[model samples]
Target: MQFTEDKSRSRMTLRSAVPKTEQKPERKQPVQELPYIKYFGNIYYFTDSIDCAIYCDKILSQVDKTPGNTIIGFDMEWPFNFQTGSGKTALIQLSSTIYDCYLFHVTEFKKLPKALTELLSHSNVRLVGVNIKNDIHKLSRDFPGINSTAMLNNCIDLRTQANITLNCKQNWSMAKLVNHFLRMQINKDKRVRNSKWNVVPLNNAQKLYAAIDAYVRITLVEMGDKTKVFQYNYENNTVDICINIPFYDSVEELTYILIKRHDLPIYVDKDLIQKLSDFSLQCNLDYYDNSTTELINHSKLNAAEVEDIIKDWERLMREETADYGEKGCASDEELFATAYHKLVHSPALETMLQLEYMYAQTVRQRVNDKDQQIKSLSETQTDEMNKAVDRLEEDMTEAEINEIAARHFDDQTLLQVKLTSELETIKEAQRREYREWVMQMLEQNQANSSLPTPKNSPLAPVPPGPIRETKEDRRKILQSVVLEESFTIHLGSQLKQMHNIRILSADVMDFCAVNDNEQISDTTPQLLQTALGLYSNDLCGLVLMTDSVIGSRLTKDFTEICQRSTEFHFPHIDDQLEIISNTAKKYQMESCNNRNSSSKHLQPGDVYITRHSNLSQVHIIFHMVSDDSLRANDINSRHPVVLGLRNILKTACSNDITSLTIPLLLQYEMTEEMTVTWCAKRAELVFKCVKGFMIEMASWGGSDLKNLQFLLPQGISSDVFQSLTGMLPSIFKVSNPLILKSSSIVK
Candidate 1:
């Protein structure tokens, strides 16, 4: 895996050696000349640093001088693969027939003058491209300012347009469209061929390929009459207009809008990551490496003999319960039974199992040792603090006691602080130690002796420094500190800040009061107020969860509050339907208005209203989206109602309850099985929404829910109705039906 001095050349040689049967043939000559030039399209060709700078200047000047408005087609090509650790867009090839083709070699552009950066960010000039979001993402990775005001105001992404226009069909590729409509083929043989764009003396074929890519986008606009375009009003789903342009503004506005949207967090079993990594390494070490050598040494054996043995082993493993069943095989059962057998049996296979095993074991051991050390240090500090507290309890004067307590607390706190500081100092020393150890080991093995020193290797010596707390840790610390402050200051400040907030207006306040009165019927206003209160209470409970001292108590309070909220449902049938429809639509699903129709269950995007007129009952319906529905189903089948309850549970009770959302189950006269099924589906959806939210949060590097685990307690199974009624009281004793009625059911 280590590269020597001729790393680039080595990589190229390896790429060239790869079997080409599956790959598209490279272009042998420049594309056949066009019979006629029907349109006067602009093509900007950029290859060198000088060309890119000059091209950018020319485009900016044209944008500044253009009258009225100008629409331009744009697209970018970049190098991407597993080899590039940073996943950066190695080169940015942008094109427009109107402005010509410009290949901004991002590698060089990053090093050039900052003037071009400003020109690219210019607001008036729009950039039109297919899936421009990705292009922007790639650009922003290297140049943080690329997305600022300097960039154009309107960034039209053709992918979004195609999605809307084509009713979400799959064929939105640029090449596909050109081939289908324009009767011209734009070759992509070298698009991802891994050629280095930074090299000098580019050939004519590469230049032509770059030029045509830009030209095709421009040509699409000129021939807009040939395809359908979709337009819609911002407020409604109804289509407003249809028109075609070679390019439209990039989806920067939509991107910004989505950036503000929040998603529920997904709960990942952190343990799974380590397990998978270990399992994969073990498999490679045992099977992949050994098989390669075995095949090379026993080249006389026919491939069929090896394949048969693998297949027979797989069948026997499936029938028996052997401890090492598949693990004993060089290839695990899955691999041994599949493509790996053929690969390992190949005469030309390269053997590296023993080497790979040594490398993986070395790395894994180091990481595990570091983790164990950190954990041990933390536990030792905790034990010391406990002992200090026990000793302090012994008879001491008030002043002496106070002084002792303060000193003990400070010392305990500093244990970690000091350890962190020390760790940083030792890290530098360790880096040097690690490097020497690795070099000595490599020399002894003589395996990677020919390889040059790895500059970016994990084992490479690194400078020591304080390990910065993660964003989540920082947020938790801030929340804890804020909570510890005087309540009067915090409460008074919050109230003052919210005095004019529309969510807490006179009307809302009046409704809250009215809803509080047991005498009043559950009117729509009361229902709305109750829902808002539940949401607010849930948020308050979340804030309380951040407090280490009061998390469990706050969670119990939250559950009680939610139970009370859900008891007071909307009195009117129409209002209930409206609430359900509105909530569902906000979550981007259709209202389940026509429940009597063929569709009895709510689909992924369907929201519905169910009215039990006989019982004078109303409920809203929503679906759950989850990647692992089966796992969710198992949990929900045990405790139905607890699935949607957002009540903060005491930390001592059990489970990590980072987030919870209430869901409305709207099925009438349901049997036990039916109710459990319904609740399980709802729970699955809630988990899905949370998972999606977590993904979005992670994408933006949000730290609020980082490292937070979620769990459903055991022993709470069967229909949600029973689970809710039983578990609610045990977890949160203040379970008034009236209070439960007021809780909001979030989609």
Candidate 2:
């Protein structure tokens, strides 16, 4: 994959690239008749020297100061390598509509100039290119810290833009965009394309090739404004252009685009449009006249159902406009559009009801608490006032008190009124406090949880579960098992081992609590405290399964972690989420979120590890499957379980976890679906996978293992537990005697 060049450094001189005598090209006015008035006419090269970079900065400064919507073409170049791994970004090419192109020799400059960085990062500037994602990805990989800030913000990927605007089915390359938009072919010389960009003095041909690639992107954007018809001629690999007519993918899309661009309203009668809108909303599907047939087939509706929908549409379109306000207005169009967007995005009605129920229940609980507080305060007030009167009697003689009371009865009455008013004010303050609490709760509950749900979506049918495994079936599974490599699997109760994996049953929202008496942290999943208790300020960590979006409604352990991180001096807690997010970005992967596709699960399994200074250990958080993926009672699919195990082992091998513990049931909360039979089958699956994973760990970069313990859920029947253990002895055993003898003899 390596590219070879001359070993002699003398010939690869940086100064040699620069022309000895500077010759400025005379500027010529752009022809007014051309479709695009301006284009790249000349290019400047910046080498390793400070002088060339300063000149580049000056040229970029001028481009930055130029007028409205300054479109700049951007691209990166590097020597081709056969290996899939990325190579360094050797050159950066930028061209402006001002007809000036700049080639930055990245290897020579070593670092991007401050002015260039600022110009690239400027929010006002638009960076245009084809497949810019690849360029940005490569830039981040090559120059991490420098390019992390260069986020390609306000970037326009011409390929995507062309697909949206021109109905392009294939990815549009620079050459294709030029041929289609400019009605001209650009040179894509293969020899120059594969040239070594890292070579010190790039030749004139290389510079022209680099400059034109960036220049065309800028020119194409300008040409896009004019109304033109494009016809792709596959035979000749060219486009036939006609003025004033644009391509349309569909009637509906075209109609919507026209309405948006021209601010035109639909001329439909009100009554007809209202009925159609209502039907679309009721059906929870987007409405379009052309999509009726497609919807019927996709929804698996019967012929009668399809007829009903057609009749509904027909009745609405035929109705009169008298009942509604006006026809052919923007307001009517907006109403229909709003309904279309809502129906397209809304979840099933049942899910919406569940959300509403949760919100209502939260509000009710807050109100109930406030009522109790108000009652307690009201009852206590009379007793407190009587006690105060008794105290006043004890402090002053009866004769003196009577004399003062007789002289200032109005003052005494005013004092009593003031006390009563003060009490009412306090009660009002409590009511306001309750209202504020509810408002805060409402704000916090705005984000929906990504935790797995049991029900299937409207589009999908539930898959039937496999029949339970019988005793004979279990025996068959163990008898037919084969191993390619050996690893020891032991079952034990002691948690004292240095490299032991302990399993515990945990709740779905287990929060850890900090032990104030001895600095034992309060958190959910008391198992963590138990695990931490095994060490006295010694380094240890455990893996936790959690949601992709960390919610305000966290498990006790998670809440404790956040609380301790903030309230106490646990430094790791502060950066825990940031570390996980940054790591996810670095790996270009995340735990399954709602936006992820069903088939693309566990593509690049990620494990988020965070250190806890308070506990003096690290916590590895593993994301479970998304809400839609769960079967019933939060039981995740088998794929994420396997992925979690693989990620855990992979992370453990690379870090300082001497011992780790996990929940054997995969979850702390047990639903009715999690029966004894289900647990046994799941345990069997986990056992086989763990053995295979451990044996295969060496190839996957795994470290040595000392002890492995499997903990059964306390609820598992003793009979089923015995049976699960029985199958394991057949699969795992100590190392063979011959191997032990051979090792002893070698020693």
Candidate 3:
């Protein structure tokens, strides 16, 4: 039999001269090949022509008919696009066993031929490729929206298989792979590789290059042993790793290489095998009896070199487990016990006893101080309330009282008296409950603070106290408690309204300022400390909103707070910056295309809050779109202000802060855009929103209400302040006006 190619018909034919005894054997045609110089197997190149495509279809059909699995080396080439990383797939090269290679010029045709597509999509065909995922990605990109069911399915990546089985490195260059596996060097000239693949007529080198790439992939797989390739044994929980161990000189070297390659631990178990150092030359004859020499076979280590190697390995293990004077001696424990007993009996014990006594005395003293403060405040509040009630009783004349009673009930009615008494009983129960909760929180804080000191240490420094108390702290504490008391709602009612919320004219930033009120000498901080009566760390954090994206910009008060917190309080400013920056980067800017037509500027409710370095404050940034950009971007006013405030409060509560401060108008800087009418409206909206948010706070998995500071802009005049104040009563119904009016000191 001989094989010959007919260029005119573009087909290869096989012929036999000899005839069989029964009948003449049927003539066979050689595999079709394109009009190229054949080098071993036929190489077929198909272009855009209909006849060429038809010829390619016939070739695929013949290759698909092969028995068993049809192994095809698949590869694709496309021009490089620096901007997009890759362009369209220009060529699709496929090669079969030994004598068949097909080069399909995919770019020439608008769509791939049906027969070619079917062969590619064939489940029976096992297409072998190197880095096939990348090729599939490129193909998908070139033919957008095309069904790639066959391209990826049943695809075996030669590189991946080789890495797991042959210990080949990932991303092995095609040239290096060819040299390594085929033991033959293949030239991959840069000029040829980087050549434009979109050009019509392909160069000889390009053809050879593409063909070799596909052919080599197939040859590599054919050369490898499939059965012994890195099989995993699930039952035994082991891997059957196959490698060319002959590359190493000895079993030890090979083991070392394998351990290093797989990053396996090399620590020897000293308990399992006795170290050579432990096996002294002077053995106990009762146990050893001349069996020591038998442990090492004479025949196995007759040579000095072999004996030396075994000795070296033994020495290595001994060195690894050696103590080397770093650990304590066995007798040290006995010595420690003796010394401890002596110390306990000596004057050191007396000194420790004295220190403990002193610490307990100091603790009691602090506790007494706190108790005194609580007692004074409670007595003052009770006396004040009693006086107010007496004044009200005195103010009402007997005739007026009788008239009021007559208006509400008949002369013989006792129902009014009964209802009044019941109301008083309910109020007393609520007050008791509130007091109990406060006491519990204070006790928990005290227990936490009284952590036991180490027994061995005789002298330990006392922990620092909370931030130094100032007049402003007292004011804030009083105001927060007052506000909390004032905002109580009748839970049974369907409508929950904020009741008796007081309005203050002073700047909220003055919370830490000094006050010289002779009657109330306590500072705001001191008052707040007494009010919380917990660990100083349970302080409230101020949630101030700003308009900066990266937090690089801040308002005056916020900047001052950050500087104070970072410079004097927290030393880890770098870490804080990194965390804030990373979090900021995560919220990427929204594109206009993704924004709604009437709503723009970062989804109205977008707010980011980060804890300040001071650990006492949280800085909140509201993503406020510029006013001019608001119309163009279609941003809603409902969010990033009211909604943002709710989010901030929720965050503060979640962070275990029972008290928080927020600007009522959601702005620290007032502009012409904020008029008196606008301020009143904004204040009213904020008041209602805050009321709802506080009511919902109980269900939002937040801590119980402690304090809330509603700040007004500094620019507001007396009239505007009063106007804003008037709106507060409508939302926050004043239940106890007399108590608030007497103590409410609006700075």
Q: Comparing candidate 1 with candidate 3, which one achieves the higher lDDT?
A: 3
Tens digits of lDDT, candidate 2, 322-363: 554235555633543333223223332233223222332333
Model 2 misplaced regions, further than 4 Å: 1-539, 552-557, 561-569, 572-607, 613-638, 700-703, 734-747
* lDDT score for residue 607 of model 2: 47
Across 362-448, the per-residue lDDT of candidate 3 in tens digits comes to: 333443454465566556656654555566656755576556445434522454345434533443443343234333433443566
Q: lDDT of each prediction vs. the true structure?
A: 0.38, 0.50, 0.51
* Candidates 2 and 3, the one with greater lDDT: 3
Candidate 3: stretches off by over 4 Å: 1-502, 511-539, 552-557, 565-575, 589-605, 612-637, 669-673, 737-747
In the range 248-341, model 1's lDDT, one tens digit per residue, is 4334332333233322122222332343344444544554454454355333223555687788987887669666455555433343223322
- Assess candidate 2 and give its lDDT: 0.50
